[model samples]
Target: MSPNPAPRPSASDTPPRRRSVQCAGPHGLHRMSYLEWGDADNPDVLVCVHGLTRNGRDFDELARAMAPHYRVVCPDVVGRGLSSWLPVKTDYQLPTYVADMITLIARLDVDSVHWVGTSMGGLIGMLIASIPDNPIRRLVLNDVGPVVTAASLARIGQYVGMAPVFPHFEAAEAYIRAVSAPFGHLSDAQWRQLTESSVKAVDGGWAMRYDPGIGEPFRQTPLLEDVSLWPIYDAIGCPTLLVRGAESDLLTRETADEMGRRGPRARLVEVPGVGHAPTLMDAGQIAPVRDFLLAAGAAGGGR
Candidate 1:
């Protein structure tokens, strides 16, 4: 399916707002950057978070599709994109991310929100939704679940801390496509958009925008090989949707099936011909999410 042009902004003359929130980290304080689309004052807010080594702009297509129905907010999780990097490598874990999200939600001043989280971001959403009195009105877990595969972790870690320099953006786009092929089919335009935000021109060359030291935590943690977050997943009480790429190596079919059988009894949707993750950048990818989120809105809230 072809991707839809982004909906005309509620006020077409204005563009998506770039906002920041001051958040505390183990080292001190940093500002997390976010792009807000749709009605800022609209009570209906949806937060879309990106995967490991990915920044928030990865959701541009997805957020654009949902903006008319929601105050779509996408955060460049600290240490990536325009957000500040953590000084302490160990601070790159989920706890800090969750805290930063809470700060962001508070800034939005909305009582509750819908969430679409991809990969590592999904884990963060699970943790947040598990908490008592949390505000995740509905949850969408994209290409990640309680259990992750060791092989997938190994594959990801291989390039997590990469610091390759490119003479031009096209060169960097090639590198990104090589590593991100696991994200499955994406148009040249989509991949190019991702590449534009993933790097920066520095010293007459380009380098990744995120802090390379973030990889230290990946190396330090033993959780990759033997991680368990079922207790957290099971505690989530909100309506949930779990989206998995049919060929995803990280979120196994077995795990995806089990997700449907238990804990939130999450509604499951699978996209064929994708692996590791599905970039909801096209109509085929974004339809289920739009339908799910709007259904939830119609049933109770998000107006």
Candidate 2:
């Protein structure tokens, strides 16, 4: 018999390349950069977005694990990472983000996509997936929901947008760790990666990778409990997974449970010994997300 054909290589082994695409904004047009992994021609796509201040590299572990199955795209969410900063700083808002994502999906030229969003990223996914003609098939909302606690908002506002200059990488890393302790149970390497992706060397020394001006719009708006996104959340019909950290201050257990009872009737998974969100940097966290997205695809509109 002929020797067994060589096994197909895993896409995880392929390093991602920085790709730029133009996006429209109220002021005009801006460029959004992303890390592309897996086969460029692959139709199955997965888009992972990071938290408020994080960059595309946050999904490095998850992308590597799922690259074998999907063309994983992780975006820097303009104003952060390698993407272009908006000329009008105050234009940063959910609506702007959703529009940029639309531009991104158009560039991908895919039939449908699976989405994973953490915190602010999750809010963007909710808005996009809610649109009647949108292409999001499966969505993973990581540690966020319609309701945001005032305490959480207060805590987040205390530091967001403040780009305190750091004398060295170690000092910046330490700051990240202090502010991000709510992330819970991250390895030293993971923390380092988070720090590296979050900062860059400025003329004087070092500062955050994201534009501090993004906070302009945030400061103007209040994240009150009364600011209900239930209407938007109810509009999304895609199969959804609500992943909450057990000790989360942002997404409470009540809200996570209510999400299961309405709208998409999302399946819920609460990660123990964590708060705010799970980093998904390890096997245990990655497994649930992988299973939910892939199995949902296999179901063929089973939801």
In terms of lDDT, which candidate is strongest? 2
Candidate 1 RMSD computed on C-alpha atoms after optimal superposition onto the true structure: 4.1
- How would you encode candidate 1's per-residue C-alpha lDDT over 1-303 as one tens digit per residue? 011222435632336899899999888999999999886666777899989898988888787778766788999998899999887888898999999999999999878888999999899899999998888878999999998888888778889987588888888999999998988888888888888989999997899989898788767764547467889988888888899999998999888889888788888999999997998988988999888877723324221
Give the Å shift of residue 205 in candidate 1: 1.2
Q: What is the C-alpha lDDT of each candidate?
A: 0.84, 0.86
Q: Give residue 152's lDDT in candidate 1 (0 to 100).
A: 88
* Model 2's TM-score against the true structure: 0.94
Clashing pairs in 1: none
Q: What's the CA RMSD for each of the models?
A: 4.1, 4.0
Error of 1 at 139 (Å): 0.4
lDDT at 20, model 1: 94
**TM-score, one value per model:** 0.93, 0.94
Reference-based TM-score, model 1: 0.93
Task: Report the error of model 1 at residue 155, Å.
Answer: 0.9
How far residue 228's Cα lies from its native spot in candidate 2, in Å, is 1.8
